[model samples]
Target: MNLNGTAALVTGAGRRIGRVIALALAERGADIIVHCYQSRADAEETAGQVNRLGRRAMVLSADQRDWNAVESLCRQAWDTFGGIEVLVNSAAVYRRTPLGDIAESDWDEMLDTDLKGPFAFARFLGPRMKERGCGKIISISDTAARMIWPGYIPYCVAKAGVDAMTRGLARALAPEVQVNAIAAGTVLWPDGFDAHQQEQALGHVPLRRAGSPADIARAVCFLVEHGDYITGAVLPVDGGRHLEG
Candidate 1:
């Protein structure tokens, strides 16, 4: 994909890693549809940045877990841009839910947001892309999807589902729309983590350091701009952390 002037939708684009990815796409000449759940202010700010970069941007709000909202968002994006050539499923909820005390609501929230959101977006937008005969869908996955994280079982399961969804969608949409995922590791330290927890997390990384949002953003750019023949791939932008035991 050339990326220039292509319409791209990035979910959870209001802040953090999602924000950087949105900006990266804008910088590369792609028009952005920035989606946020509650951070309207932040989403607007991101749109402003995209506009300043000389790319068109619009901010939209929707709860990804709501199928009706997801459908409406897809319709709105199509109505606004005429068509969407790229979709980034970056919206997710990450939290530690100890297995011993895990609640139904907790599991549902994590799975619904982290896994079902992407599934819903892809379900709604995929056929349109198929009709057009070209598109790219990039999902945000995590290293924990493939590893054991005792305190975050639900999150891990959801991400693992994301990885599966990426591969399945790739096969299903092949010869037309490309689907792929990025499995990231130790990028941004969650605000909830204490210093000791952060250190312990970092210690597992073979690179012995945390990565930046820009690192993940660059991977997204690569997939968007140059990954024409790549599909069903889970590119690990983890500074080699997935290699650790």
Candidate 2:
């Protein structure tokens, strides 16, 4: 759990919270395999930051929604880093789709990206971690999974599935590879939401503040390095926002 010589694969690590998690692992002396979908520039930037930390970093681009892409990503990580000691299922798609507006395509996309993608990635990468007799698998979840967010029905449902998957995988991969989830609260406003929107969102947080990417990253680090006895756990980094009605 020290992570001094471990290698990690962080999915959706190109920007936002994924980027921070990748960097935090690097700071702990772990080499990283950074995965991004469309943000090649941001992925490279994240790699640069990791390299600056004097750790090895490799950027792999893959669409998590594709099973072949997920398999290829695991292969690429092994080829680049020798082997993976940690796997972070951080790449995900979040959106707003009301129940009435949720088309089949929308449901499929969200389910594949948020739930099936993680399952595929973990299935492929799990053997290596098991073979090694040790590993860490962390998935980023959301408060929406536990609370009903009206306009994000699809997203909420997908994340709820992720939470369930995490617990199931943890039970299956126990005593060797630990599987955990971090349910993030109001970490950051979506790319275009303004200050007013941000404030409106924060009103739901019991702490009266939004959490930073670093806060989530730190929780991830704790799971990887110190949570030896923990598995099938869902830790909320939501600033007590889950309490809101």
Q: Which candidate should be chosen as best, given TM-score against the real structure?
A: 1
**Cα lDDT tens digits for candidate 2, 1-245:** 99999999999999999999999999999999999999999999999999999999999998988999889879978977788999999888888888787899998998899999989889998777888799999999998899858898788888898899999988888779999999999887877898898888888888999899999999999999999999999999999988886
lDDT of each: 0.93, 0.91
Q: Give the TM-score of candidate 2.
A: 0.97
Listed in order, each prediction's TM-score against the native is 0.98, 0.97
Estimate, for each residue in 29-90, the C-alpha lDDT of model 1 and write its tens digit: 89999999999999999999999999999999999999999999899998899899999988
Off by over 4 Å in 2: none
What's the C-alpha lDDT at position 32 in model 2?
92
lDDT of 1 at 26: 92
**What is the total number of backbone clashes in candidate 2?**
0
- The collision pairs in model 2 are none
